[model samples]
Target chain A: MLALAFQLARRDLRSRYLGSFSGGAWALLQPLVQLAVYAFVFGYIFRQRLPGADAPGYVPFLVVVMWPWTAFAEAVSRGTTAIQDNASLIGKVALPRAALVLAPVMASFAIHGIGFLGLLLVMLLAGAGLAPAGLALMLPALALLFLFALGLALLLSALQVFVRDIAPALPQILMLWMFLSPVFYGRYVMPEWVRPWFDLNPMTGFAEYLRYALLNMPAPGLRAMACSVGAVVLVLALGLFAFRRLQRHFEDFL
Target chain B: MSVLVEAHGLGKSYPRVFRRSDRFRSLCSLLAGRASGEVTPVLQGIDLCVPRGQSLGLIGDNGAGKSTLLKLLTGVLTPTHGSVRVNGRVGALLELGAGFHPEYTGRDNIAMAATLQGFSADDLAARLADIVAFADIGRYIDEPVKHYSSGMVVRLGFAIVAATRPDLLITDEVLAVGDESFQKKCIRWMEDYLEQGGTLILVSHSMYHIQKLCRQALWLREGRMQASGDVFEVTQAYLAHHERKSAADEARARDLDAVRGLEFHVRAMRVNGEEAETLPAVEQGAALTVEATIASRDGRVPVVNVGFARADGTPVYGVSSDMDGVQPAPLPDGDFRIVLHIAELPLLPASYTIRVHPLDSEGLRLFDTVERTLTVKGRSSESGLVRLAHVWEHAAPLSRSRGE
Candidate 1:
């Protein structure tokens, strides 16, 4: 099943990159360009810093949260119709349904890799040394990212075959989720009254952990990372559960 | 040895029907009383089983639930009613090129296809070369599949599944693809697989292929099993039923035209053409003759026309009495026999209707009615449209040429 997922993901990657200049390079280019403009406008013009200011530079600050957020959103939207988009295959071939859901997740992971490297370079350029603690946490952070993607991918892709409206509705919904995620600023930047709320949010802990990893910052902590991982598992399980329940009806509806 | 697949009361209903009824009902419920309509059931109570190593052929006319049954068997479309169980893995050519990515190379797609069909990474690695060679697109294997032709796509697709070697192979019309040579190759490969103890379940229109391949055949009518038994018996019955229906149709058509005036007109016809003389029933080649008669009017005269239309309205030739009537004389008062002489009939054994028209000397139409179905019952085109004299020769440069 893993081999199938990767193979399908490779097809998607080839399709998106084959005709463009610097094939496969666009994955990094998109996130890098966005980071550069944000860093210049906010850090240079506004003369601002990270929410904690003590943690890292603004470019890394934005990237740490932006990468995972973008990955989550992309996985949900693309994975939404992953099966229906290949309705012939789903209807004709006997393949593991799980692989179809995970295909987009693999593609998103490709982009996340590029975005992460771009963030690392930007942080170094800003005179922030790489954080050892941040490096140590990259593995867990990646697991969390994949977990969140799997959950949303399964839920959205399965429904996409039936509802169809879900694909068009994703961008608007994901846009709302972006602002709500603390990607632009830090959890500390939010009002103290809502600090507890940000802590509870799955996106908040993820951002803090990623930043803490790259800049050698202090502990983003075991409790926060554990909470995010737990939420990831719960979401994935529920999403897959929903997907299987709806899968049998896909052929008629698709 | 064992039942490989079985379906009990398997059923499926497309949502299009329910959505349609919802519209009618919602209208009534909104404006007045509750509305209702019957939902169309696409499949109902389908029960079938194929034991291990058995080759099953499904035969049905269009819209008889054949495709639906195949879909359910392959697990593409789930049954809305009973559960389905299969003991082993299934490889299917359900929709040709279903998993092919237009932008990916043939090699890449082979790996992806194999994996999707349940092969492991190592398994694909081992079968990679064999898959490419089987596709027969030598140098283009590295190119993106979108650049490949439709035939190439099937070659690659068939190659991939053949390599996967699933426990059961379920194929629809994938065999009816590409050129004749490719079809022969695929059939031979399938036969080899069967010899190796692999199972096959096929749905096709080629009665000859099915009769030869399947020991037993199934006949489906309106989503129900009409017959399931020996291939020869079932297929013959199916053909006979259609033939009978067509014959009855021809009879009704003749009756409809029977209402025309026989006096001073063309009456009933047998062959629609008649030769002045008759020939032997058993001869070197079969000859078709059209015979007809015109009732002479007391004062008025008419020149009639005769012609033949191929099975599909293709006009063969037409002869009119217009040229014969240029002297202002009507056809003979009684009957006239027009014979179309042919040493051999070129058409295969199939049904074709004949046409007879009535006209004047100036080619002005008087009356025309098509009648007489000419059924050419022959095994091959050797009993051809025209008789020909020919010889066969073999030449050798070092020796001499000989003709027979």
Candidate 2:
């Protein structure tokens, strides 16, 4: 099953890279354009800056947060229809069901790799000092973010099969989710009272941790990071549970 | 032979949701562990078994649940009731190019499909050349499957299934497509597969192919078992039933056509002086008699025509009273009765239809027809509609000569 999953994932990644008009260059270009837009709107127009310290310009700052955020959003949206879109496979083939859900998630992760490269380049051009030790921290933060995204993907993909409205409603919801996570601004921008509410969003700790990993910025404290990791584990369990429960009826409905 | 696959009272039912809102509601209700909507049964109480090394054909009309049964056996759909136990690995071609990623190359799709079928990466590598050779798609194997034609897709699909070489091979109408030569190749492969003690469960609408391939057969009608037995017996029975049904339908349609005309009408028909009713069974060399009564408008004798045809609508022979220089005998009520007789029927062993037609006295045009189907019951090695009365005599062989 694992072999098949990797095989399917590799094919999916290569095909998506080749299926579009721009091929793999589109994967690099999309995040680059999005980061530039965020930088212009927030850094130049709104003049937002990191609180009480040296700021690594908004483009590099936004790139750090957007890298993981984009992956999570893409995974969730793509995963929503992973099983439904493969209705032919489900109807005609007997395969490990979880592989369908994982394929899209892993594909999203692969694209994220290209986006991270763009982030690294933007940081280098912005003259952010290279801190190898601090850079190592990105691994744990990125791993946690990947797990959280996969969990959401598993849950949402199963739910979308039963309730089709999830597919159409996902983009707007992700837009709202991006605003709620501090993709454009720092956590300090939120007033103390609203700061508690900000921490309630699991992605806040994630974005803050990723920024800290790359930019030598302030972290979300130990409690927020622990809570985020705990939430990741909890969502992973619930996602798998719901996915296993829903998949048995997938053939009948799909 | 050990049992390869067994299904005891297997069934499946799908909930019918009439409206989009109702579909959402039913889905929610189902997820909530509550009864959803009105259940429509697709298949029910289907009990069957395929022994190892046996070839079983699943024959059915459209909507008779043959596809559903194959799906159940292959574990694509869970049975609603009872259970199915399969003893060995199963490779199926349930649909052409199913599970193929359109954007992936044919070779890539083959690797994925083979791996999903439980072949190791190394196993796929070893068999890659053989699979590519069998598919015979040539350079198209390197192109994405989306660019492949339907036949090409089936070629790649069947090639992969062949490479998997599972213990039990299940296919649903896989032989229906592709060109004649490819279909012949698949049939040849299937023959070899069966010969090597491989179990097969084939589903097809073509009785000829099924009879040629399968040793045992199961016929399904409206999701119920209609017949299950030897291949020849079940296919023959099913075909005979189909022939009678279609003939009746055609007769009804022709009856409407016969009502519109007033000049000539056929009233009754008899075979061998007995009223031609349901299909009557006869043997070779039997004296065949056909009598038909016709009514005319003006007390003039109308030409009567009798014809014979195979049940599949192939014309065998036709003769008219006018052509034979025989006049119809006048009846009491401006009606006429025509009697046609054959001293010895030369038809081979198969179902046949005798058609009676009324025409003008000159036999220049045809008016109406009434048909009766007869089954020639005796068996012979000869084929086709007629049994030619001829003999072969022994001859001595001559020695070969030098270059002419």
| Candidate number achieving the greatest lDDT relative to the actual structure | 2
**How well is each residue in B159-257 modelled by candidate 2, as lDDT tens digits?**
888888889999999667788989999988988888888889999988778877788899998988999988866776676677667665555546645
Candidate 1 is graded, for docking, as acceptable
The residue-level lDDT of candidate 1 at B11 comes to 82
Worst 10 residues of 1 chain B by lDDT: B275-284
Task: Work out how many backbone clashes candidate 1 has.
Answer: 14
Q: What does candidate 1's lDDT look like per residue over B289-324, in tens digits?
A: 555555443344556666654444445556665654
True contacts kept of 1: 0.67
TM-score of chain A, all candidates: 0.86, 0.92
lDDT for each residue of candidate 1 in A1-254, tens digit (9 for 90 to 100): 78778878877787787668888778878777877776766666655454444334555567666777777778778887787787767776667777887888888887676667666666666666666456556767877787888898887777566556678888998888777877777667667897666656677678777767765544455666677777898888878777767666566556
Best by TM-score: 2
